[model samples]
Target: MINKIDKLKDPLVQEARELSSSKKRIFKNKIQLRGLEQLMWAKYAGLKIESIFISEDQNVDDYSGFSSPTYQTSNGILKKITETNYLIPCVGVAEATPNNDDFDDFVLLLDDVKDHGNIGTIIRTGKAYGINDFITTNDDFDPYIPKTIDASRGTAFKVNFKRYKTPQSAVAFLKEKGYQIVATSPYGKSLQSTVELDKKPIALVIGNESVGVCNEVLEAADHIVQIPMHTGVESLNVGVATGISIYELRLKEVLTMLAEKIISSLGRKVSVTSKLIRRAFDIKLKEISEFSGDQIIFLMVLKRKSQMNEEQIGEQFGYFGDRLEKFISPLYENKLIKKEYEEIEITNAGEDLLAKLWPIHEKTENILLEGLTAEERKNLKSYLEKIQQNCIKIMKYEV
Candidate 1:
């Protein structure tokens, strides 16, 4: 049942107030909320709403599926959303914990960054670029504040973050686990010139706005990095600096993601092209015979169904008249084929060469037909042949 407490001294109200404050910290599973936007976003993220408080005149239909305890208040005491004292139409309390997964090789650490708004922006920007795990030093502002949530537009609730007692402790633990510490500083090498990211499993530290990274923390960094600015500009906003640094540090992942998108748009045709297949076969079967692609393909056709005369061979393999003669004469001189009356047959030497190259040819076939069922492979071959005939028709029509 959703409990409604109108009095300011109610125990639930006290708990909500405490949960909403930064100085008095309680590691409760609940978080403070404000506005319809925050409540809706929390629900969209699939968080469990513990309870909700609404104004006396507001209809409950706006919050349909949530079956939590609903409270209607007239004094607007429960409606004081945050320290800003804004009386929003509705407020909610939802489960604050996110579905946290294992951390990636790259991590973002905040060192004594006391601004709540800056912390929220950092979390929002970090999540956008694939850095979900964040660690905060003890002096850093609490991420659960209403200002933080408002600044992030409720993205703060969706990110994975942990608060550490000190920057040194966090850096020490990360270093022990093989993460290189890279701290941002105004005096450090420019981000464009930094080569530390060539090494993986890096922890990028963004510091307080006023004091910057603590001297002790800066001393512990494996590499200190900075973004270059124009001569008159002294520094960048912490949030902006962090965003740029994260992009530069994760540039490899960003490029790989873009390449995958391009490849996906073009389909897997890149892997199974005619040119690539021809090159692979040439390289794989070079030892058996010094035959070109046309010669090898012609020999394979005869090997499967022998005794093919000139016109019949042309019909079967698309070789005609002079082209057919060119393919056969070279094989005849090499003792690979014999002329038996009107029909041509592969000679003993040809059979020996085919036997030597059979395994490689079959392997090449398997590579081309990979990830397909037997039926699909047959259908694909039929489709390709149809496409080839269509191409021939289009060429003849143009001529």
Candidate 2:
């Protein structure tokens, strides 16, 4: 952001640049905490503290029992240090790195997810669900985005993340080290059947919201499962879906892990169905955002009606899926059209959710296929595939 040469006081980035080197051990540990809110939040959030910065005008007496090196800087000096044109009286810098787990149990893989809020929410969910140690693509959003940072409730500081230039590299690292890679796809096998939950040590890769996972990334995954839908809603918001998926997957993994342990150590498989159900409820929250699946169905139908119908919608259920009820109940509850209904309409909510459904559905079907059950999903699949083939043909034809 401070790209202009003149805008920078130490335009060379000498401090950050110098700190970039592993030497300067003392300086690396010397984190300067500035601003009242930063200090308060950092303190409350249990982040490590080395020192604090305060402006002369602020009420010093407000903070009790907190003492550190206090430096008096001119308004210009404070502005110069953080290297921002916009001035803030305070900020916090902590010389702390969050602990990274190896994720011997379960972890979340970020494949070039470049949105700041999305990354932060992903991290927050990872932490919430007892997942740590991210193996993410090099181009993924910075975990330290101010919006991400705030959205994460400071949990970002507590997460351990390593970046890889390609998702393949990360997958290789995890696989060679022995971890199952689960990729999420709307068109993939149903979640319930695809994942046994009884499997131990898995990594779930959440891709870009718009394009989903790249083909290379998808090929790298061990299994793919979709968040099943009823009516016509195609996908869930990346953050919301990521939270639900991680929560469901990890908890199930944990229980299955414990079951495996009990089976091994105690020579018995312990049943935790009740506990699993409760955990699933708490995590797979009903945040549909749309009024009904029909709302979503109406949109997808409006988008691809010539290609799909209700019979195809039924086949998706025949596929093993998770959280399908969460998405479908409302549509069924409201009796909205699912590509088969005659009267069709798209509400404001439907339009909004539809914008997030990217890379289209037929592409989804061809990418992840099972034998066509009743010809409805098949018809939709065929329609979509033909359209895509025609588009490719035309593009090549144009050339």
- Among the numbered candidates, top lDDT falls to 1
lDDT of 1 by residue, 1-399 (tens): 334567767666666666666565336657777767888778876778777778777776876667777777644575443444556777777777753436677788898888888988998898888777887778434677777888787777777777678878878877777777878888886463454454447788989899899987899988887788899999899999988888887874345355555666533564447668877788777756678665777777888888788888787667787887776788999999888898888888988888877787888789878999999999988988887798689889894
TM-scores for every predicted model: 0.62, 0.55
Model 1 compared with the native: what TM-score? 0.62
Model 2, position 280: C-alpha lDDT score: 38
Report how far off residue 326 is in candidate 1 (Å): 17
Candidate 2: tens digits of C-alpha lDDT, residues 100-201:
445546778888787788888888888887776777877333565456666776777676776677777888888887788888897787663346743647
User: Residue 131 of model 2: what lDDT?
Assistant: 71
Number of clashes recorded per candidate: 1, 8
- The number of the candidate with the highest TM-score is 1
